[model samples]
Target: MNRRTFIESMGILGAASLLPISCLHMQPTTNYKLGYQLFSIRDEMTKDPIGTLKLLKKLGYQDFEIYGFDAEKGMYYGYTAADFKMILDDLGLTVSSGHYGFSGFLNAPEDILIRFVDQCIQGADTLNSAYITWPWIAPEQRTLDNFKIMSKKLNIIGEQVKAAGLGFAYHNHGYEFDDHNGQNGYDIILSETDAALVKLQMDMYWVMHSSKYTPKELIQKQPGRYVMWHIKDMDTKTRDYTELGNGSIDYTTLLPDPIASGLEYYYIEQGGNFAQNSIQSATDSATYFKEHLQKYL
Candidate 1:
């Protein structure tokens, strides 16, 4: 049977029967590390990547997920990948993942797509990131055909990333859940791609905003597919970005089954509408994680 068919037949049964009871209760074997996405402080990163890293370190963030890798410049936020790696090392921070746009893969010629993937692999290797993620799909390119094309390219790129000793992932936005002839873009991508090659980095706010599936339900439906999570909360009223504890998602319920969810790393990401200063917002999220979320970890 195909991957999607097999997944459907198993349903929640597979996840329920296969997952160890201890996964729901056992503490993480290693140190529980909390991370932040540098996009949360894009302005600071643009002005001074080093200063941003230092401040994030001071806020008790040990890991990060970065964005804006310029393939042509061979840099992220204007620093060469190697230089950025050095800065991270000096601050005792690790970049577990980074976001890269896939426009070249979607629109460029085959040779250009190959070059883009090569650049991504090189940058990811330099930063020692575990996953290099495709983070967005433009509104105009949300068709099923586009998703199919993306799936094929993602599988190809994922293989190259795997060969380079890293992983490839897709980061979700609410658009993926939009209905398309009864099969959403997300369903197409998940079903069409090789699971071993393409992992998922689920954003909590987007998942909630989609109103289709909850984080826990998605985990149960597609066990071991999601490897990373963007932990942003939705305001109860506006359903927009809010600091961790101040929002609507009861992470307390969703975070306990990391093994079942295939969650290896999670980064707190607050996108705009910060309750206070962005740095302070990040600190508050970190504080909540340390005080409340660590128990699950």
Candidate 2:
């Protein structure tokens, strides 16, 4: 059977969950294991980082993707990188990847660029994550020339991070989908960057919500460049963030070409509407993916 057929055959096994390990026809790999970017849990984290990590573990997360590690603070939420790493390790969770904002470096004085880059490098290295990302672009810097400038600088930033032994990526939001000279900024980033040196972390929700392109089309055309993906969902009525599979995206079509798309990790993100709080939002996403995504797998 083909990969898709094999997955479809399982169809949400009930006996398998209770049976011995050997009887299982499907064993999820790290590739398919559900993970959440800590930013989705940012509010809970601000309240208590250690408590948040414990809660996420209880909610069935084995992998994590983090953001906003202020080097100055020496901790993300009053927990040092070493301290935070220990907490995750004890819970059998791994920090798969994270967002590393480079706008500060891109906008800082020349003398301060290296300092900012070093700070990012320090946090990424400390966490042992595979990819560090520049999360978004400032609205005012939307001109074609600025896009080119951003690309050149990102390429430079990729080189610097790669030299430090970590991969570099750009994470998209809806703004990058807007047209400039009838071409999008995302097009420029894709065309200008060296694929070997840089990777793209496709934010599927933003691409779908803002642009006409679908995630599958982007992966098909840009194969091997998208190393990570933000698996966010959007409600059609409000165009706002929602739980996975509870929104309009067709994830079945999206995951089948994982290898072709060069995807290593997929991180769940819900920008806001943490009605119950961040950990609860994460648990809802993880639970949804576990129960519903298998059909699509």
Candidate 3:
């Protein structure tokens, strides 16, 4: 069955009874707490890291996942990890995790792995996060052999990270699902990697966009491997992202087995939102989750 039908036809044990209360409750409740990806506030942060963080605190966010940090300036935009962490802590927010790219994974000299691990350790220390995530792969490096190479490297990285009292995970963009010689890269990674070391941070919107499979099916297929998610909704008609709950991704239904999808932390992201103000966009998404996702609890 197609995704829409697959999700629709599948019965939730308490869906009907749950819906009315979830949809009708006007008091503003929270089922699942939410997080913001620092990248979403890149512009404002680039201009003012401390200021932007203060704004986020004002927005009522309690957790964060960073994507970039400018060491020289001591910030994600210009503050150091410690400085940023202080802001988050002052607001009673935690920095759950952050995304690093593939460069560290494919280091030049083999011994560089030690230095790489140290760098990740330092970053994790500053933020007090237990995870350092690899969030992307070079588009051209999409191949079975490349994936296998990455899997091996990631296993090593994961081991190193674990030793440092932190965890390691790979985040997906849509490209990972593209068929490479009849095999999906994500499937390859899952099948071949060390479960104890490497984990998956599935980006639900991208996974849905890629047409590889349904989010629920993948979660069911590999329970507990997904430890986090990048949550956003898709405009079914436009085949693009929309604010959460304002679009068609039925998060309510998905919540019954959220942990099954390996979800421990969920961050809100929108790759594009041309019309709305960026902060407003994120605010709307968070508000939707606070309202609609409450039923899942």
**lDDT for each candidate structure:** 0.85, 0.76, 0.74
Q: Which tens-of-lDDT digit does each residue in 57-85 have in candidate 1?
A: 88888999988899888898888999989
Q: What are the per-model C-alpha RMSD values against the true structure?
A: 7.0, 7.0, 7.5
Q: Candidates' TM-scores? A: 0.89, 0.85, 0.83
Off by over 4 Å in 3: 1-32, 70-75, 104-107
The better-scoring model by TM-score among 1 and 3 is: 1
Q: Which candidate is the best by lDDT?
A: 1
Please report, as a residue range, the 10-residue window in candidate 1 with the lowest summed lDDT.
21-30
The residue pairs that clash in candidate 2, if any, are none
| Candidate with maximal TM-score | 1
Model 3 agreement with the true structure over 1-297: per-residue lDDT tens digits: 899777776655347546543343333333445678878767776787767777777776767788765433444545567776777777778888888655544634557765666676787778899688888777667777887888888898888889888889988888778876788888778888898899888888887789557776777788898888888888868968788877778876644355445567778887676247677877787778767663453
Give the Å error, residue 127, model 2. Answer: 1.2
Question: What are the per-residue Cα lDDT tens digits for candidate 2 across 237-287?
Answer: 787888776678877554535666777887778988654666667878888
Indicate the worst ten consecutive residues by lDDT in candidate 3: 21-30
